[model samples]
Target: MPFTASANDFRVAPATVTEWKAVYGEVETVNIVPARARISGTVVDVRVTEGQEVRKGAVVASIEDEKLALQLRAAGARVAALNSQMTNAQTELTRAQDLLRTGATAQARVDAAKVQLDVLTSQLTAAVADKAVIEQSAREGDVLSPADGRVLTVPVTAGSVIMAGEPVARVASGRYYLRLSLPERHAAEISEGATVVIGGRSNAEQPRQGRIAKVYPEIQNGRVIADVEVSDIGNYFINERTLVSIPVGRRTILAVPPQAIRTVHGIDYVTLKSLQGTLEVAVVTGERVEIDGKEMIEVLTGLSAQDEVVTR
Candidate 1:
């Protein structure tokens, strides 16, 4: 006896079972804002060059202000003078009390001497405070770094005269982040501590991992903004306006070639052919995964590991 030839007679490739899920994401990039100087004067010294990493509070540049230095010196001299006068007054007061105890000075004289000592003491304190203010101003002449970062721009060279509050150098901090602009609809899905995949260029393999550190409260221009800090990205210093791709979420599901599945009567079906026969099996489809521009549909049901499906 010979068996009749049917659709099942044609051998079909076995469907490779795979789990997949819909992945929603957006393109992300690294953004940076340079820091500026708070005060300025003539650039006396440039401590850091371009691309030099600096620690927080490190002196990046120094400004020379002759007038400020002179003021500081004068204030220090005044303080020293006041301190000497205060010491003399204290000695005199001690002597006056001793003389009063020995009945060689009137009590009124001793009281007057005490009042003079107090006045001198107050003057000394005031002078010391004034000197501190002057010294602080002098220290401000040297521009210090606000945070740990690399010098991105040195707008002024040594001996360049700069006005007060003028920027001498621009610095990009060592800390880096991926700034993502997501659609307003997806804003609610993202929050601080969310996992993300960060990579340079969309097609790059082996992306670095990151986590959401901050999420903006309000939407701008129909987009919600967030920042992801790339953990363990190494010493690579990303500059402003560098484009990168970030994967916000991922999952797994059953997938098959889109061509292998067909729809009829508002139902998804795949032609399952086995050695026994060919049968139409209804299946619930899930998210589609695109690999090399070919689409694969996720299978939910009506298929088993032992069955084979033909892509027609």
Candidate 2:
């Protein structure tokens, strides 16, 4: 006679199973901007440092302006001198006209004074315009941030001379994303907007869901690169690495609670409970996964949807 035992039986049923492709990736900023020098001069001031957050149009560095300041002063002086000369020329013209009306000066002398005043006036106008051009050049000496972001590097210091267009600091933009390189063989499986699971193994917090944001058409080093966007990514550091899962497609299969299947002598088995009795049956298993927050084992073979498996 067989021994009797009380057990709970689970009815096997076909459930939707998603086929996921697991890959490794890194947390990265959406954009990196190189804050560079707009003018060639010695760095007079360093206003920002690494890891500092800055807003758009914020001053990051200042180039030496003593030379520019002197040039501006000289230009102003030249304009002032020209204005004084114009004043003297106008006075001479007025005096010449007064004398000609009184018949004390020749008409030709008044005409000469008028020409001299007109030349002086033209010279003053040109001098003022030249000064404005120098003033604009002085304004461009201040280096500014292109966007709001965190500074990654400040390569120059006070008194360091740098050339125009040289990078003064490197910045990582505010938006964050995950960058993954998938195997080339899985190229056909991935698509934009595919569901993704992020940081399941390393992150202590509950794993977050993300979606495939982009897929590059170009393949390199036998892999295809892609980007994923996730929510609540503020806590993650830039360039930090994490595990990611992307589901390519789905299929219907027999799934059961993990407790229902047990391994004996290196072989997987499930006990089938029927009206007659309990019977031990050999089975093959695949990946263990969670469905709707419940852990389930994939029954690849040796199990059917019509069977009732006993689980203690």
**What TM-score would every model get versus the actual structure?**
0.55, 0.84
Question: For model 1, what is the alpha-carbon lDDT of residue 61?
Answer: 82
Q: Which candidate is the best by lDDT?
A: 2
lDDT of 1 by residue, 1-312 (tens): 011224433222233332221233343333233444555567888888887877777887888778877878888888888888878888888898999899998899778878988998888888888888877777787777776766777788888887777776666764566677777877666679866655544465466667778999989999888876776655554433434444444444445677778899899988867667777889998767653355666677776544567667
RMSD of each: 9.4, 4.9
- Cα lDDT over the full model 2: 0.85
Q: What is model 2's C-alpha RMSD?
A: 4.9
Clashes of 1: 3
Cand. 1 TM to true fold: 0.55
The positional error of residue 271 in candidate 2, measured at the CA in angstroms, is: 4.6
